[model samples]
Target: MSSTTQTPEATVAVVGGRLVTPDSVIEGGVRIDGQEIAEVGDIDADAETVIDADGQLVLPGLVDLHGDDIEQHLQPRSGARMDASMALASADRANVAAGITTKFHAISFELDEETDRSPELAATMTDAIVDATDLLVDHRLHARCEVTQKRCVDAVLDVLDNGDADLVSVMSHIPGKGQFRDMAAFRSYYENSSNHTAEEAQEMIEERMSIPMETIRDRINRILDRAHERGVVTASHDDENPREVERLAESGVDITEYPITLETAQRASEVGMTTAMGAPNLVRGESQWGNLATIDGIEEGVVDTLVADYHPPSLLAAVFVETGESLPERVKRVSAAPADAAGFTERGRIQPDKRADLIVVDPEPTPTVTEAVVAGQPVYRADATTGESQ
Candidate 1:
């Protein structure tokens, strides 16, 4: 972040902010030369465009590795479906406004999913995400594979081979395992998440439990193999045991998303995998499903990245959560660490010659994204106080 850059020479410059670099924070500005960061700190030359970042914090834009907010956008209300393009647009704006420049939309292919997330809908959204070019943020796909469903496994494989999935994760959420270690909790989660009645939820849980462990492992292995072959980052969801984490790490998994226990998270870190937890968990101080707290993971040095999960804005809020760390360290969990976890190298840190993806944050009463810039372009601003500076 603190690089020895040349004299300021660029088309656009953001001036007068506490620039949070990797090493330290400085009261300076950043110069953007087209699509790259031309210079940082001590800019004196005039430019055609200038964003007045006075009294704010200028940090690299967040790179969210996984979020399911797109699904929420698609069905904002019950029993209704929005257009694919519209949903993508809304989600893009939401993420960018939340200071997220790089987003991995987690689309799940599951058996007992709601009506809005059919196989055809998943395919449509996949194509939509790929074909979209007018988005403000860099949108990528994270295909969530529910391995108990053959259709889900097959769909993820096709998407992976076609180069549509940037990140792939294997999810086997059968009862009495992982996130649902308690049988009563499994029934409650299934009954609440779908249209299934109590009896139906029980039946579905029993049916899923009947799926042989061998078959589930086989399906997960196939997905992991293809993901490795395609050179895409792979993740295991809601890991519960150290043994399971070790097995996934041996298989070359790059990340472990939301390990349910501290032991599992430590095992993931010991085996050389990036551990990610939900930003909301950090903001709310606990997991939504009564699992390991994100603060515990951060304090234990087990978690390396913070994802949006279902709440896009929580990422920005979590940054200023008083985690007993410097702002630069907390910022890296959402930006540099996540970018590295996802195998991206172009735009995480605010260094010279890196992609000029940045955000100006107002950290007073609440942490809010005042302006967001992606690829050297000013894509969003909270107000009109961003133009030429004298």
Candidate 2:
């Protein structure tokens, strides 16, 4: 799903469930008119469609703040990429089944020819997502603009100017440093995924690492200037220290994604920037990259929102794992808080006049996603025994 540009207009009645919204919970039914939630009450009202949400929990559809899985689908392997449309459809299906109603497909547009290089491929993939918006659930582009790739930046700007891009993030994946700055780790990552031999991966890493940090900073500033001019929401990636957090705050970046330390997250919070951590980090009880755990940020009261990041199912599962907080309190970590941070006023809550993005989960020993409604249209439903979209 590339865009959330369309919504349905029919009325739907979802009854016999506990409604979980931004501000309140009701043991009743929710009414949806096309895409916007028309009402929430206990009256067993009937509409064109009626869902039997008996003994279930109804809440807002999961809103993923950031993710790179879409790109993974587009290019599953280095050389064995799938058709763009088919990849998108499959990814969207996977996300919907995992309870995400709104998804931000993080597509990296970095033009290069080394282990990670492609201009035509990036354009083709992004265009495919933009063009296929109507056929999927609420979808939007979260362009991970790599500053090192100048040509890729140009392509991304063209797409942004054409109103094809929704959310834009300034990313710098320098060869030997930052997110994968360690030469050994970088080589391992390349060798594990691509057609590169271990020797070739080392050589590529050495070649890229030789570039000065000043050059990297300059490229980032250029991208930031262009991004700010377009009125796009800008975010800093993988910030690991207080200095990095301060630098990003000074640049007027309002969102901090994946801060690597608790101090960094605290600094971001003090400056009023929203801190986003991966939900998987909480579920796994540790950061996969050995960075500061998101649970730490939450404990310190510094983390504001949760993103699905790489795995869609982690969002719902993480809520259950959260200790000490009530289900309603834990929900703010993913639902209302992220919506406010992303500046989406119409979503993230169950309220009058809000978009009707909701899911019905049967709260068994293990919760089950029973029905999912997007913009008042029933998009997914599980059978009594078969987990299928009805």
Candidate 3:
């Protein structure tokens, strides 16, 4: 939980760590000059600070394209609420401690009859995330716009127009499709999460199904257009089939966030779309909702990026899961691939001239983040007694 601000003359050299580059792992370490990586080979010159990472893995800081764990911080329990800014600050501490230096806070614009996720609350949350500039890690907004909720479209558009949205993802949580494709699962989720009865959930599902397909399509296109005009990255959530993938590709979505099936993910990859899966899925070895297993998708070479999703710490552990790829390649799935999917060309790799966003990890007894540096600033360090950061 200790941090250090980087001065203009501040320089750091991490020596003896296993440096994970985009292509290879170097036993030698790296040198950080100012806010950029100065060298990736042997460092023979003197430096202001030197961290001996002798038996650790030194890799680029994780870039999470989508993480919604902040919601738990905002409302730790039912009927309990905390200030959005305070919650965001707490989330930032957790994210940085988890070795995630760059995080896109996924804020939902979906209005629920039984929840406080109204349009007004969404705007307030977006502003809170935007105003939280004092945080140590880089925080961006990923506006999850629900196309089924026509009333929320204008609010999402406002976020895009005002430049509060760094990335916009279109999602439709209507029961019978997307994440809740199985009616049994949908009923269970609605009854458990919203305290809705079976009859009420069915009625709600029918009402959502009554919405015209053209209306949903038009609203999604409008939001995507606005996001594209503003040069923001856009994504489509829970693609169900190849036709949905084609539609998203045609709508100019750069990334596919969570395909429900392996075929759909493969189709997205075949169509040249960046396919993203949740890190928790890989770590758990299965999808939570009986969807396509992310490990299988990785083995099939269809999944491109691994996001933290609802668990911020899963990104680091997912890199060590036994995928058929090399260590460098697996690390790229959580780091470089996510950064590239989010249109961040400067980070996600430890190379010369790139931003000095790095993490020192102890990979032996357990994969844990020992230290995390973002843009040459030391943001988090693990406690020696508890072996935990923050």
Candidate 4:
């Protein structure tokens, strides 16, 4: 009798790792046939290219809904701006290194905030995000409209009308409200942000406080309306209380990001709106503004998504922090949850027929991304070819 030999035909196989799926954790491997996953558990390890992930966790690539790190990359120092393409490329490397497969860059539009970088950068930044193909990770535009300024609203609406922005969020940062509820901290923060004198910062804060809520709401509604008509997702930032959450929910805001209080987050959840908190808040165990701690929302089951905010690494670090939840559930906070919140339906979980966007994580003394694969192609790989991290 003649026996025929079987050949492994997968493009790449990530083996010997605990796979964090959407609903469960499996002690097996995954195979990428091409751009999509072919097998989930007990995958054939003899593929053309095998990545041994023994003693590590194989997680879905992180989907960062809101990250301000792009701005920092654009302007590394006060009054010093780098080339837009170069800055975006740098941010892309940093994000993929942290296992972020999809990144929503937050572009703030404000008036009279010269040090916040020119509000004109909004159009330039949005164009860069849409046109750049050199970026390794998937990039989207998050238009952050500061409602106190009508020009800011106009700019964001134009982006929406042009179908350039993927997400839209309305925020009003008056000193006595929202995240700046602590007026002292607010003044101190403004003073420290630039060379502005205490008086100049106070003047700026007071100027914002003078804008009536009626005016702010009108500007906010216009942007929200345009965004909705364009089928773009909307969010309200730094909600202060349940009443405020209710108001935003009534306005058809689909998300509440960085709710300042636990009650606010709970109200958002109760009203069927998705709640997102910053990953830095969870990693730090408290809010910099002394607002509701992110753990409070996690313990209460209110937080539906965790964004990168100003720090991308915090997202990966948070999954290993032991939050009393299974690894699969905790992994969803950064991957599945944010991906769903951002309306990215195709590539958040590790499953057959899904896009092969995955990360090999070594969670020993800390969680570090060793290899990142997007669309079945390796984008980054650390020099761990010899040790157990291979």
Candidate 5:
């Protein structure tokens, strides 16, 4: 949660844009001196660069706490692979175009024999992400450790100890609970993703379930301890029940990600833990796999942040879909809330002396990003006709 180096002694003013603040949207301008916001509201100061935003809404750049879209860019096909550094550079541009100035790439340490998400590959990707100094946006790693993968615990510890991970989330994907509560859905997912037959999937599930709960707990605690030692944030994923939520909260989990039911989400909220739901779930109106609807969770006042999850662009669109709340309130779910949850307090809002990570969106007919400025530097500008970043 460190601020980027300030933009060299250059002043840029975004004029005539509707500034979306925490409580209201004011029709004014923002002045950026160096990398921090120098002034906001009715700025009339002469600046070296003036970007006209007459017909756009200037909001804080989106902060995505968890996004796995980079995995698609890295390994588009089952056997096909792209250079990790090249894929990370592409991911940076794509995220900035989607108005995401701060993002945490969710890399998995689930070294299953049936898939390519191995520990070695995860390490390589982590190094690539860390070495991507040319990226236009701030990038971090969310090391998703599959607790059931006992052999991968050392690998997860290595990443945490090496300072490659900013956040660590422990996930237990045992069948008959959590995301795969429905056995039928579990079978379908396993078969479709791994090309396994029903019998093979069932056998795999049985084998995974055979691992002792004590073993799983020990592995998870080890990961959490290492994360704590490194001062990295920790979260629990796919919490299924109130008991599980309470256990994770008691274990000092900072956030609860994708709680499967309203009761579970409520439990997390009651325990004062931040709750995160997927933006795609809100936009799709339901969970792709059978689970609590994100919109419903939002209505119930349980969800605190909205993560892009699999679709980076869905973050902005999800803000518009939340018509019940004001634009400022809805935008926080994708920006300030997530940033604060991830311990990034400097760049989530438009305030004086804060990092100038902002985006301008045109909300006529359909909401689209017109320009994205990160740390006072304009990184992505959309073509007026095609709406693609130039």
Candidate 6:
């Protein structure tokens, strides 16, 4: 008879801190073994590493259900580029420092080769993500597939079909119609904020906005069919109207990312699609694009997850800023809600058998992350430097 030897589980007991489990906050300790949480009681046990939380609030590590923070890493400017591996490394470290254990790095696949949005670059980035994550926090690819990019959809979908894509978003950006109907308003975004000349802005928009809306929507349906078949989550980006929300729901989209208006947000909620708002919007005190305030959406009970958008630390910062009635309840907006939205059952909660991804916060109005543990390993320590620099 052949027998196999079982591996011994490594355990660490975290005691004396305020433990924030999924169900409730306990003023006690937790025990973790290897990559899973072991206990949550007062059992005296030795640990390889002991974190003295010292009355700090212990919560699950933040889950960024949506964002494009990594895009800056790959492409620092419209024309400038960097090494894929280096960019991923930098972005990954920034994300971990922000207490993000799970990240969905939004990469836009623009159809036109001249647009600088390349499938080749995305594939390279995805490969780097798989390789670099061996010793780092969990990072995944979220391709913001502009439905208008008819030529690139096939290539982008190929990545998804091959398991290269983690989250696929279907978005349509047409000028003088849909989200860009207000040409004057849209002009301000490209002209004033981006500092693009009228001709340059028009050309770029013309290149992206050239595709027909009907064709793009039809293509979205096709991609959704494939995504559903693969069990990959689908999200509708920048929903502007009720009809769009209804259509996305019919297409089996569960996440509605950045609904531009309040009506669209409400419609998405009515349809039971989890709404995602930008964390930077919350941190900056308002939306840069002049959309519905995330705070308002949260108040209306329409917002479900907080995405980092452009800055990873904003995810943790937003939680502190929104603790109006209760801190634990507000923290859940960043932790549990986004984790549930992303369909990650193990990492979001501080429960036994769950992945030991947790953080210790100072419990102040502008709380700082004291420690960050991912899969039972310390990835960040505030005393080691709190914010991103370099």
Q: Which residue ranges in model 3 land beyond 4 Å of their true spot?
A: 1-5, 385-390
Clashes of each: 0, 8, 0, 1, 0, 0
Q: After superposition, how far is residue 277 of candidate 1 from its true place, in Å?
A: 0.5
- Candidate 1 residue-wise lDDT, 1-390, digit = tens: 011122344377899889999878999999988779889999854877889997699999999999999988899887788998999999988888889999898988875554455555777888988888867888898999989889889999999999998999999888988888888898898688766688888787878899999999899899999999999999999999999999989888889999999999999999999999999999999998999999999899898999999999999999999888898999999999999888888878889999899999988777878888888878788863453211
lDDT at position 177, candidate 5: 73
Residue 84 error for model 4, in Å? Answer: 1.0
User: What are the clashing pairs of model 4?
Assistant: 52-390
Candidate 1 lDDT at 246 equals 95
In model 6, residue pairs whose N, Cα or C atoms come closer than 3 Å (at least 3 residues apart or on different chains), thus clashing, are: none
Q: Which candidate is the best by TM-score?
A: 5
TM-score of each: 0.94, 0.91, 0.95, 0.94, 0.96, 0.90
Worst 10 residues of 2 by lDDT: 1-10
Error of 3 at 96 (Å): 1.2
lDDT tens digits by residue: candidate 2, 125-241: 677777785544777777777766667677777767876666777776655445675656777777875567888777766656666778767766766676678776778788777
lDDT of 6 by residue, 311-374 (tens): 8888888877743637667677788887777777767887888888888887565667777777
Compared with the true structure, all predictions reach lDDT values of 0.87, 0.76, 0.87, 0.85, 0.87, 0.76
Tens-place lDDT digits, model 5, residues 1-390:
222455599888998989999889999999999888999998976998888887689999999999999988987888788999888888887888788999999998887656677888888888887777757899999999988887678888999878989889999888887898877777789898854777889887998799999999989889988888999899999999999989888888999999999999999999989999999999889999879999999888899999999999889889889548888889888889988988888889999998899999987677788887789887778976786667
Residues 1-390, candidate 3: write the lDDT tens digits. Answer: 122356878888888889999999888878888889999978754777787786689999999999999988988877688998888889988998788998898888988746557777788889887776657888888999988888788989999999888899999887789898887787789878855777877877887888888999999999999999999999999999998998899889999998999889988998899999999999999999889999999889999999999999899999989887899999999888889888888999999999899999987666888888888876678875587655
lDDT of 5 at 239: 93
RMSD of each: 4.2, 2.4, 2.2, 5.8, 1.7, 4.3
Decreasing TM-score order of the candidates: 5, 3, 1, 4, 2, 6
Better of 2 and 5 by lDDT: 5
Q: For model 4, how does the per-residue alpha-carbon lDDT over 109-220 read when each residue is reduced to its tens digit? A: 8765557544687778887888788456888899999888778888898899999888999999888788888888778887887657799988978789889888888898
Stretches > 4 Å off in candidate 4:
1-10, 385-390
- Which parts of model 5 are misplaced by more than 4 Å? 1-6, 197-200
Candidate 2 stretches with Cα past 4 Å from truth are 1-9, 111-117
